[model samples]
Target: MAAPYRSREGLSTRPGAYGGSSDEIQLRIDPMHGDFDEEVSGLRKQVRKLRDVAQEIETEAKFQNDFLNQLMEKVLMPTALRNELPD
Candidate 1:
């Protein structure tokens, strides 16, 4: 069986002398310290930096692969066929 929900005006519940609810009475409270906006901004900056680095790495890898493919076709193919020709 569920207990009935009561509004603040209808209920007699009050914080103790220390100004905390009974459920939270036993726990020691810490002061709030974090700036949410600054933390989010820092994370956004890190993400942008990582995204830029990843894009640079991807572009370099693609260029290297294409260059290697062209070098192989232009240099190795003729040399290999020359070596394999009947002489």
Candidate 2:
């Protein structure tokens, strides 16, 4: 036979339940007034900073690629071409 079900105020009757007093469980239903605004502002600032950093990195990468290509064309290719010329 199964045990009968019981209902207690602010208490759980399930097996392996947290056996603490109801006062330990605190519930908050407050509205997000100022904290939400502050959090959104902080997130926007961080996103802007990250975007600026990404742009800088992209610019630096493009400059480095161009410099490397110029070096190959002006220095390495001429040397290679001279070696291929008839003596």
Candidate 3:
């Protein structure tokens, strides 16, 4: 299961990519929308923003985990127990 994508408009939208399988559910899109290009531009911008946000989150999580591990080893570990951890 994947997380639902959220757009800048705060609307939760299914991903724009389509599965080629014939059994997949088809969604109805508004064909009469004023400008298709504008819609695509908006979606592109939202996707970029989401990608950047996800990357930032991943980097931050890694940094925090590494920091916590170092902090624990240096401050929480007893001298006798330090050797128990793998180098």
Candidate 4:
């Protein structure tokens, strides 16, 4: 059987291998960093879509409020004037 591998000062035994544990840690974390960046971009797009929807809804509500106010003014003005006139 081959000799059991021993790590000296957390270094890999293979020749030409660099910075054992720290290199391994970087290898593991690189892919996760890419995935995290992708997820953040996706979330930003979703937030932008939600913001656009909110703006559209706000604009429509304002238009409806203005329309209702104009309708009330048209309907009530003649009645108010007639009530003020004598019989």
Identify the leading candidate in terms of TM-score: 4
Compose the digit string of candidate 4's lDDT tens values, residues 1-87.
Answer: 122233222222333356444222111224533576664575577669979999999999999999999999999999999999999
Clash count for each candidate, listed in order shown: 0, 0, 0, 0
Question: What's the distance in Å from true for residue 79, model 3?
Answer: 4.5
Please give, for residues 1-87, the per-residue lDDT of candidate 3 as tens digits.
Answer: 232443333344343458543332222346674456776787678679989999999999999999999988877668657778688
Question: What value does the lDDT take at residue 4 in candidate 1?
Answer: 25
Expressed as tens digits, the lDDT of each residue in 1-87 for candidate 1 is 122222212223345568654521122223375555655575577669979999999999999999999988999889999999999
* TM-score per candidate: 0.57, 0.57, 0.57, 0.60
lDDT, model 4, position 49 = 90
- TM-score for model 2? 0.57
Q: Please report how far candidate 4 places residue 3 from its true position, in Å.
A: 55
Ten-residue stretch with the least lDDT total in model 1: 1-10
Sliding window of 10 residues with minimal summed lDDT for model 4:
1-10
As for TM-score, the candidate ahead, 1 or 4, is 4
What tens-digit string does per-residue lDDT give for candidate 2 at 1-87? 122222222222333337643323221223543455654575577669979999999999999999999988998888999999999
Give the whole-model CA lDDT for all candidates, comma-separated: 0.61, 0.59, 0.64, 0.61
| Alpha-carbon runs more than 4 Å astray in model 4 | 1-34
Please give the lDDT score for candidate 4. Answer: 0.61
